[model samples]
Target chain A: MRKLRYRFSSDEALMLAYRDGDSGAFECLYHRHKDALFTFLYRGCGQPNVVEEVAQETWEAVINAASRYTPSAKFRTWLFQIGRRRMADHWRRVPQQESPLQEAAEPVAPATGPGDEDYTAFEQRVLRAVGELPADQRDALLLREQGFSLADISAITGAASETVKSRLRYGRTQLRAQLGDSL
Target chain B: MSRDTRREQGDALPLPEMNSPPQLDEKILAHARARAPQRRVTSRPGWMSGLAAASVVGIAVMITLPGQDGVHDTLPAPHWEARERTPAALSQPEALQADTLTDDVAQDARVDAQNGTQKDAQKGAQKTEGASLSAAPPKAVAAQSSARQSAGGLREEQARPDAQALERKMQAGASAKKIGRASPQPALNAVAPEAEQSAYRTPESSIERDQEDRDGATHQRMIEKGLETCAALLRSDDRPAAISCYAALRKDCGDCTLPPTLDAALEAQASDSVTSP
Candidate 1:
């Protein structure tokens, strides 16, 4: 509820500490990327509920796995990678119905929470357009928008770096088309 | 038109972004903060810097930190700790003999403590003896017999740190000898009844051994060993050795009752063997 009191170094640093039983570091990490991750999931999967479930599950996996994670992998890369695996698992558990984005775009509900109406509005469109994309293209575009390097994106997607670049090239081109006059 | 105009024009479109809901970040971050894992400062030293490096450097750093430092209590490597921590194997007549000898030595030290004359000498002896004798034999024994219960070898192997090597081994010995693979018995009942009660049954603690945990260890070990052997065989092109080795492991464990997931794991192992270079 209150702002967490932690001087975190980086997301990776925070994850390392959190993995070793540092709750505050985890809180700092959550705050740092909560929106980015939620936006990533919300847009990537197109179900606000699934976004919430997967995001929560992702955090749980990170917590449960603090000790087991390898430091050789980038923290974000690992987190998203785990998130994607969980997403796949979730789908496997339940059948793949249409994502909410295709059926209907979820309106950003007013809450006693963070974010200005302006940014939420901008992100929501980015979110829906993203949902309408093919899984690979959607993930590439979303990762790029969230400031992932192509190499990092490639690692997360388990594709070659060049493949990631092509995904981005194709993804951005699609976004440019889909965003239409907005581009 | 550039991204700016495109974004601006897209702003007015029938897209989801056009509707500005209040406080979405607040809602999401609120959940993130509520559910995020706890984070401690990096007293464990330069960890988590591996995101950008290649695999080798990352593995090196991780290995450098191997288990937790003594202060932290997390293990560095499962193999060493696991072997040291199990006690069921100690009942093998050989290991128990070691335990009995240690028990006598412990009694002698207790007697020396009452006399209060050789306290310093006794403490030093106790420390080394404790390291070599107090904790490990029963562990090696228990780990072998208890393998049937814990499912994920990784979980059991990793979870070994939760139990003191001595107590778990003794407990495993007492239980395994009594139950013979029905349900898992606690692994640390070496000390007197009062001490055992105090150690494992503290208030707010439900530390009963998980039924699933035992099965997990064998799975974990099998998978790890299989993967390691597979990788090695691939590099060496030792086809006959690899297949035979895999078959032997499978046959040995075949009649033994296993967790349901094991069938899938074994199948995966066979598939990997087929596909491996």
Candidate 2:
């Protein structure tokens, strides 16, 4: 009965419940967002090991801050914001190496019929193109894809709405140019 | 921007699915559960403090005021009854004694009035006989009798038509004797000067002796009254009242010894009660 109630609860409600000592509410909230948060981190920081570390740290930060949480923004926006910061912190500690996307990229696909084209290869190319984008653009693009408004992306990135818009536009234009015809 | 425009402008990248590890989930959930807020113990109700304060105040009042039950319990019953009986005894003695002695005095006064000249001769003979019976020195008795005769002659001269004055004088003498019986001071003071001048009897010593006698009389009266009450209860077959009355008498007059008849009666009643019950 309690689990049913927790499952149906909104993200903000779950966080509030966790704040008031309902560990099950936190479990529900963690499960709901863990995959998206892990993916965001995994894509942003292209190493699984670093992604795991950052994801763990981000969730730990959320757990530590449960008592102090306030529903000022969307739960996902706040979560991604913490993840971005953790990733940035990791980047600061260990300088960025050669882009992992550069090693994974393949030759541009020849113009052909949609049925004949390798869709999986095309999808991988698209992922690499997104990963290859500048960090700010990638964050703005990824946050926008995760269903945040331009304003929400700005809030998560601590950037102006105009800056977020510019980053998103720049990131999309670059992805289209890199994955031409197979788009 | 419109949804279509925004979607058209963004990349169609297929992001790979990812999730935190099972061990990591376990670790984080465990930490959260460990650090969860605990339910606080509820405080004592407001009425409890009020009740405590009321109890303290009640105890204080009980301690501060004199206990009416204790005063009644500790007071000796016999002495209390004696004190209650004293006023009636003091107030009624004259009336009580006057009833007994009035006829004798009236007869003597009438006889004396009828034999006027012979009364004088007879009074002289009677005075000599009273002086013979009195333990006072003869001279002292003669002097007192002479003083009384002179006072009686004056009284007779003032009211010669009736013997009422003589009767009044006799009643006054009887009342004086009653008062003397009630308290010894007046009777002691009435002693002849020769008797009062005895070596051992100073005024202070006489007063002390009178007090001791008064106390002894009062104690005796108390015991007699208590015994009478016990006897009445026993006669009425109120065994409990009788037992209680005897118990009180024993408590109040610890040195008093009960008469054999009353003691035996009480013993028989006690044994009967115990055996019957």
Candidate 3:
């Protein structure tokens, strides 16, 4: 759709306008959040098919619920919470599937030194290490990197503040161990 | 372990960049567009509604106010029983004769008061004239006879004239008699046919009047039953049900006279419904 003459001041405003029959406002909101939500889901679940399905379901939920949406919390927090719940539901249905980190981890081929090593291979290793962290720690770290407060992370994950802090601590320690010297 | 180190670790980690396929965006946008709520249409402006209401009232007044001079067309024709039961008679001439008799009797009483005796031959002459006037057209004569019988204690010395001569008396300014003496038949005769011409009647009005006359007693009974139901509902605090009863009553028995309490209840309910959220 072409750009709307009316600019929405915030995600909540856009959602409200969409609720009141302006489909174009929803288009703007969808564009703003689509990529970030996809990234969040993908990092949490390495399978492309699972990422695509969960992302689609999350956005569909947002669309269906636009009429009843209230601005009680930041739109990003709400969106991520939906995405996290979708991912959890998927895991419950498929409990025997390979862990996300194991699914994506490729064996590191031998190289003389870090300087000579492939940058893409190192990036893959880093992604694997991130995926390997316990789910709570990985979620806290992802939310923290996205500039959400610890309180916001706790809300999305349904964890207490202290528990989220401990998870982040353990997640970092384990990641540093796996990515030794290279970090 | 420290906040600074945690910050460094977050900064150093590669944040994944994942974009949904174009197909998913299309699907989501389609769903959103399909599910978008319909916009509310604006209400009619207040001035326009007010103007419409004024026009309706104006039209109603024009329809009802013109033919009021014709008594037979406006009010229901009095039943013979109602006419008979009325304390006063229904012919204007009879009232005039009665008034004339009252004056004569007053004059005689004053004379009698001044002097203790009256002339017998003069009294006999006045009684004969009174009997002569009592011989009027059949309907007027019957009414006068009935009136005289009812008012036997009233002066019997009054003479009554028939309908034809009485109509002349009516046309002659003795017409100033009170409405109590206005008979349905005489009033009908007095009105010009053009004056009797009323506003165009809608089919609904014709049907309403016909059905009303045919089923009037039944409708009154039904309205009484409905009022009982409405009262019961209201007592139970079921306002919506009570309002529904009032609505049905208004539609069905609109012309029937309601008790003031029921009318006030309906009006209060109407206003409350309009003003309540």
Candidate 4:
């Protein structure tokens, strides 16, 4: 985070002060970074529901950690990094869903019977496309599209820089082939 | 930090326009508070007795005072300000009503004067003084008459100041230099640009002051008028928009500004409810 010469105190100290019950510190913190943080979360999740959930979770983590977070690094870097991981985890749990695929195949319960076979076929095709990519590559590619940096991915997955780089490179190449004309 | 990954400044980040989940805020805060460790200490029976004694004396003293000028007013009685400016609110309404209150005050003054003369008459040693004592009530009536006569000289005193203050604040807004309306325009203009902006940032502050002083259907309408103006501003100008929004929220909804997530949550819940039903 960029530090401006605001009257009273430093940002980290103010945050720590807020943890000790100084509401003014929270005011300063929110005013200073809510806009950029929200923007990051919005792009990082792509899904409005997911973005909002991740943002809230990230800020909650910040508030809870304020008493414990060290001044070793910029507060926002740590903050956004939490958002990045939450978004990636969120995607993994729900799976990346596209609107066209949903419309192309109506949702059918297996309990509903064989009348939905056509819908199942469309669903299979979409799933097959995603399944073609290796797991590491698929995650890396998704993270990139979600606006996570190679460094952010590294932090999120706890992967080495070299590993994350290779995964993204291989992932993009494979995704291009799978996506074909769509790419 | 990746090489060749840099894009346009605009593309690097998303601009935040929308709000996040409200439940998440409550959840996080509630969780944090629940997790927060409580400080522990022991209480003694001996100390309890002394503490109770001090509390009793303190409470007794507080109950005895008028509270108009007491230490208990440090934070002010729920809305002392609303009560403080109430006397001035006597000026509102049709002159008939205002005149009624004035007449009430005059009647009290006449009573006081009559009582004084009655005491003087009872103590008088001479018939002349007793006669004069009989004359006291008439003198008070005369005084009341003269006070009514002086109204022509006091019209400016009674009306123009509050109206002018309201106009300066409503029109000048961020330019309102004095937190006060009647503060001369030059003095208001003398307010530094930043200070002036801050002054009108919460126009409702002054309006709140006015409304709190006089809480009747008429004042309520005036508050709603201020709110309508604020909501209109929310639709039109961007200056002071947040304050206007806060004001409208306080006026209409108090502290609950539902997060943008509320609409999504409501939509999600409705879908789920239909499926379950």
Give the winner by DockQ.
3
lDDT (10s digit) by residue, model 4, range A1-183: 223433356767766656675554565676566655664455333355666677777777777676666687556556666766776677678757642122222224332222335445433333344345665664555456445677876766668878989997886566446545332
In order of lDDT, best first, we have 3, 2, 1, 4
lDDT of each: 0.53, 0.62, 0.62, 0.46
Candidate 4 is graded, for docking, as incorrect
- The top-ranked prediction according to TM-score is 3
Off by over 4 Å in 2: A100-118, B1-11, B39-277
Could you tell me the TM-score of candidate 1?
0.37
* TM-scores for chain A over all candidates: 0.78, 0.88, 0.87, 0.51
- Give one digit per residue, the lDDT tens place, for model 2 in B1-277: 5434654664445555467788877877887788766534479889999999999999999788733332123223432232223323533332222211222222234445465335445545655544443545546545654464345434433333334433334335433232122211111222222211211112222233346556776766776677679989988999789878878876787665553355663565455431110
lDDT tens per residue, model 3, B1-277: 4435664665546444678789888988998899887755678888998999999999999788754443334334332222223335445455435533433333333222233235234445656666665565656655665555556433222212122222333334422233223333322221222211211111112224335445755765676577678978988999788878877876776675553455575565455421110
Q: How many pairs of residues collide in model 2?
A: 0
> Residue B55 in model 2: shift from native, Å?
12
What is the C-alpha lDDT profile of model 1 across A61-127, one tens digit per residue? 7766766655787788788888877887888888877765664434465322224564454445556
Report the lDDT of model 2 for residue A114: 30
Span of ten consecutive residues with least summed lDDT in model 1 chain B: B199-208
Q: Give the least accurate 10-residue stretch of model 2 chain B, judged by summed lDDT.
A: B195-204
User: Candidate 4, residues B165-249: lDDT per residue as tens digits?
Assistant: 4435545554344343322112211122222222222233333433533444444445345445554665576548735454554
